[model samples]
Target: MSLLRIVFKSLRQHLLSTCITAFSIALAAGLLMSVWVVREQSRRSFTQMDSGFDAVVGIRSSQLQLVMNAIFHLENSPGNIEVEDYEKIKAEPGVALAVPIALGDNFKGYRIVGTIPEMFTHNEYAPGKKYKTAEGRLFDPELREAVVGSFVAQKLNLKVGDEFEPYHGLDFDEDHAHDETYVIVGVLEPSNTPADRLIWIPVEGLQFMSGHREESHEELSAVLVKFRSPLAGKTLQMKYNQPDGHLTMAWPIGAIVAQLFDKISWFDRILEMLAYLVAVVATGSILASIYNSMNERRREIAIMRALGARRSTIFSSVVLESASIAAIGVVVGFSIYLLITTTAAQFIRAQTGMVIDPMEFHNVMLFGPIGIVLAAALAGVIPAMKAYNTDVAQNLVPVS
Candidate 1:
């Protein structure tokens, strides 16, 4: 039989051993792939959703919370500020535009925003594009008309001309539903941001529904401001830090990204450490298996040598067997990785409303398999050398 055929036969006979090695390698590859997928998707999603506003101006709160509430619309605002204060900031020298946000109430945990059409117009998300309505039209000047985001529309099965009563508080059933119903005049095209998860109405409408009239000091959740120049962020922050200032100004993009990674640093580190540990264990297992199997194959190696198989051929065959097993492990591991990531996508979206694309391939994923293959080859070196040095003469001698 050819050396390749002999190798195949041997592997088949040692099926358990081969399978164990492959499984070990697969686990390592799968974990690494999963990590790459999550990291890449998060970076892409955050970048895409956080383009327009340079800073978020809000009542004194955690910097991260301010970004979460203002840019992501994920958390509640710390407190409310007067609309007049927002107008003053809008007129500041380096300010390009200031968009006011009024938030209170929810439809099944998703925030409802009250703002002007400028909130959509001035947004920088999905650059070079504006918030387009997928159906119907934007909110009209008339009170009680609103626009629903695509996610909201799909989840609630709402369309243009449909009317729904807004609740007064966060809970779906606890708070009293607004006595007044709001007509869904429009449904916004999906921007894949918090915008897609919110119901938007005219600021005046929200104020009226909440009982805040123009004559009184009406409070706003936050203000999103774009800068005329990049340097304006630092200058504005300094100016807003005066003791008399009741609000805080922050660079949304920088602050949000930094604080996000910072909070998750421990989790990231744990994953990375586990990945390394898995890799080491996989290599050790493969190496130990090959080293142990060398003793049982010694007589077989001697028989092959006697049959005219060269030392180089014996060595190459052993190395090839290791390489084949490693390759299979990598393929199996990637399959498992794909399965896990795809399965969790929906659950992740439901819980966090963050979309995760599993099939997206990155260059980093290639390294896991390559490393496994190299480790497997190295693992076979000792066994391959022992096979090369097998004593054919001694093996051929009969016992006295």
Candidate 2:
């Protein structure tokens, strides 16, 4: 029989061990691939998150928390600031434009932002890029209309002309559903930012929904501020962030997010180490599976030697057998990796409303699987050497 046929026969004889070892390697590969993809996608998401606004103005609160909640529309707003106070900042020396932000409601966990049509026009997602709709136009500030983000529209399955009532605050309070429903007049184009997860209406809509009495202080959760220059922004941030200032200024959300990531980088490092440790255990499993089978395979090796097989042939066949298992392990590992990542992408979109493209190819995955293959080849070394040293005369004698 050819070397390939012999290898297949030996593997078939220990099918359970072969499957177990390959499965262990596959599980390790899947986990490692998942961590790599998440890391890359998260880095991309953070790097591109800035919408070119220079600063955020909100009621005196944690600057980091304010920016995260306001600009990202992430969570837990830092209360509200008087619109009159915001206007005061808008009229400040270097202020270019101030877009009002009011958030007091949600629909199924997606934040409902109350801002003007100008937000899409004046705001820059990048240096020269502005927000635009994928299909319908921007909602008119004069109408009782809503504009949902691309991810929001898809998750809620909303379309232009659809109408829905928002619940009070971040919670889904049936008792606090707004008296009036808002029609979906438009859907913003996907810019791959947290903005893609919001539902927007005119600032007046939120004020009206809250039933504030006439002449009451019109309050906003925050304001998006752009400056004429970076120096102007720094000066304004210093002025507003002063202890005497009722409102705080948070500049350049990109920087705040960077600090946040830096603080948590150690946790990410821990996860990475754990993933590699699992891979090491997978390699050990390969070693044990092949090594344990050596005794059972020795008699077979002796018979082949009697059939004129050289020690080199026995060694090569044994190595090829183990290497084949390792190769199969790599294929199975990648298959599992693909399956898990695709499912995770869908789950993340459904739960967190974050769009992650698992289909996007990441470079690390290229060299990673090859490393697993090489580790498997190395795992077979000891057993292959033992097979090479088998005694032909001693093992050819039948046991009593």
lDDT value for model 1: 0.78
- Model 1 agreement with the true structure over 164-213: per-residue lDDT tens digits: 88877555764667677888999998766667778898876776674444
Which candidate should be chosen as best, given lDDT against the real structure?
A: 2
Lowest lDDT 10-residue stretch of candidate 1? 208-217
Off by over 4 Å in 1: 1-6, 171-176, 210-217, 343-355, 393-398
Count clashing residue pairs in model 1.
0
Please report how far candidate 2 places residue 283 from its true position, in Å: 1.2
Query: How well does candidate 1 score on lDDT at residue 174?
Result: 45
Give residue 77's error in model 2 in angstroms.
0.5
> What's the TM for model 2?
0.90
**Residue pairs of candidate 2 with colliding backbone atoms:** none
